[model samples]
Target: MSADQWIAFAAAIVGGALRVGTPFLFVSLGECLTEKSGRINLGLEGVLVLSAMAAFGGAYWSGSAWVGVLAGALAGALLAALHGVLCSLPRVNDVATGIALMLLGTGLAFYLGKPLIQPQAPQLPSIALADWSSNAAVRAALQVNVLVPIGLMLALALWWGFARTRAGLLVRLAGDSADATRALGYSVAGIRIAATTAGGAIAGLGGASLTLFYPGSWNEGISSGQGLIAVALVIFARWSPLRCMGAALLFGGAGAVGPALQSIGIAWGYHLFNTVPYVLTLLILVLTCRPGKVAVGSPGELSSTRS
Candidate 1:
């Protein structure tokens, strides 16, 4: 390839990382938070879809992208709150409830979002970091979205909070031992519910990023298994917010490979390249999810012995 092609390919990957990684960043963080609280939300896929629909609809109706983002967050929180509430009941399995919620969220989004298929919604604002660049490709590559910094700040804040805050310690305690938490007079249910709901709200931002920013439209297939993939990302990150951020970027870059290759006129294996993220997910799981070995930093409640 020529120098210009190489530059374009590199720029495409950079741009794709920024654009595609945002959703992964948010979802992974959400999952990390939920897992830290000892509850797994498999329904984040649903949260992503429902919230995406809600965000798009909210932005479309209110004519404000910010409103759409909030709508998405609220939708995710509400759905996740339902999961938390149900799981609090005796004999209700968190995993089963989460799966059911995923279906429910998806159905609700599809039914409600049917009207949203054709309308154009307002898009979020972006920062043109590459405006000073002489190359058009470079300029396009560096047009970072506003949410990227927000995601970064969120990851840093979560890492700090988990390590430094009293509330963080309590959450870790709850995840490690429900009996210990209850013995201390803290309601495990309450902590978990709040954590799950908060995680959902954060994940909802990822949905908003999808509809209000990247594709700038609502569609049933918009999520494309990102929510599911984020579960693995959490495991891959071992529940570290900082690691979650890094994993998200890695997955984002993996996702960008296909498009970058296509941009450089290597389209023969475009579809194959798109499978990189999924392949990476499987590999990570195989490497980390070994038998008889708990992943480092996994919450005690989620450990094989407890589970």
Candidate 2:
């Protein structure tokens, strides 16, 4: 490729990192938060799909993109809360309950989103960062969605909150030792429920990004398992909110490889390149899941820690 082509390709990857990474950032952070409280919500895939549909449908009906985002958050929060409540019951398995919720959320989304598949909804606005560039491709590649900044702020806020806030201490205490937290007069179930719901709402924002920003549509295949991959991302980040952002960008860049290469007239291996993110996920899991290797900074009471 020529210098100009290379520049365009580089710009595409950078922009893709910002664009594709937004949802990953949100979902990973959400998972990080939940894991911090010693709970897991494996059903974020369902949350992603359902929230995407809800966001799109809400935007279509309300004529406001923000409203769509709200709908997505609410949908995710409701599903997550249900998961939390179910898990609170005696002898309930968090993983099993999450799987059931995933199926339920996905089925409900498909059924309700049928009409949304054919219509256009209001889309989130973008910031044109490459407007000064004469190259059209560069300009196009640099148009970033507004959600990126919000996600970044959220990551920073969460990291700070975890380190400095009393509420954060409470969550850490609950996750580290439920018996101790209970002895201290805190309700372990309540804390976990709140954390899970909040995480769901955050992940729901990721769903909004999928439908209201990039790809800009609601469909059955819109999520493509980004939600599930985010669980692995949280593990990779060792449940650190800030690290989650960095890891998300890495995955986002991997995901962008295919499209970036295609922009430079290289399409022969497009499908193979598109698999980079998934491949990376597998590699990360393999590397991280070693015998006797405890994740640095992992919550003590996390189920994985016990396992």
lDDT of 1 by residue, 1-307 (tens): 9988888888889888888999999999998998899999999999999999999999999999999999999999999999989988888888888899999999999999999999999999998987776888778777777899999999999999899998989889989999999999999999999999999999999999999989779999999899999999999888999999889989999999998888778888899988999998999999999989989998998883432
Q: What local distance difference test score does each model get?
A: 0.92, 0.91
- TM-score of every model? 0.98, 0.98
Report model 2's TM-score to 2 decimal places. 0.98
lDDT of 1 at 17: 88
lDDT of 2 at 80: 89
Per residue, candidate 2 scores C-alpha lDDT tens digits across 87-112 of 88888888888899999999999999
Question: Once model 1 is optimally superposed onto the true structure by TM-score, how far is the C-alpha of residue 24 displaced, in angstroms?
Answer: 0.6
| Residue 153's lDDT in candidate 2 | 95
Screening candidate 2 with a backbone cut-off below 3 angstroms (N, C-alpha, C), the clashing residue pairs are: none
Please report, as a residue range, the 10-residue window in candidate 2 with the lowest summed lDDT. Answer: 298-307
Q: How much is 48 displaced in model 1, in angstroms?
A: 0.4
